[model samples]
Target: MFYDVFVFLVIILTLLILSGLVSASEVSLFSLPSETLERFSKSKIRTHKLIAKILEHPQRLLITILISNNFINVGIALLSTLSALRLSYAININPEYAVSISIIVVTVLVLLF
Candidate 1:
């Protein structure tokens, strides 16, 4: 039970970090000025050209980022719930209380970090 909970925590933390990185990328990429993009498009560097090419279809990038964020958030929620259930059963406590606590705690955590 302890190992299962630890694994769940590790996964949840990773997913949270991934979600944050994805969100940061969305902000940073979309916030770039037109001049910067233009420079990137004309740059000799392969990486810059690739970035410009990918950014050419802003709609697709936005959709992809949004989908990734959604999946990460859902995974965190699912793991939290499962861990909470495991905890409730292990301690012979009311499952609803454990689930409710876990939900509140996880939500706060996701919001805070």
Candidate 2:
């Protein structure tokens, strides 16, 4: 039980980190100036080429990022609920309320930072 909870916690943290990175990257990509994008599209560098391709379809890229972020947030909430339930069981508490509280707290923390 302890090992299971530990694994879940680790997965939750990983998801949180991934969520942050994806959100940051989306913001960074959208904030780039049109001149910079044009330069990237005309550059000879391999990385620049790849970035240009990604930015070519701006709407598609934005939709993909938004969807992925939503899924990651949902995963985090589910894992947090599971972890709370496990902890509540170990301490002989009610899991029903714990799950709701944990989900709300996790959502708030994720949004705040």
For model 2, how does the per-residue alpha-carbon lDDT over 1-113 read when each residue is reduced to its tens digit? 77778999899889889999999999889998989989998999989888889999999999999999999988988888888999889888899888989978897868953
Model 1 stretches with alpha carbons more than 4 Å out: none
Off by over 4 Å in 2: none
lDDT of 1 by residue, 1-113 (tens): 97998899999999999988999999989998999999999999998898899899999999999999888988999999999999899989999999999999989977764
> If scored against the real structure, what TM-score would every candidate get?
0.93, 0.92
Task: State, as a TM-score between 0 and 1, how close model 1 is to the true structure.
Answer: 0.93
Top TM-score: which candidate number? 1
Q: lDDT score of model 2?
A: 0.88
**Model 1 misses residue 14 by how many Å?**
0.6
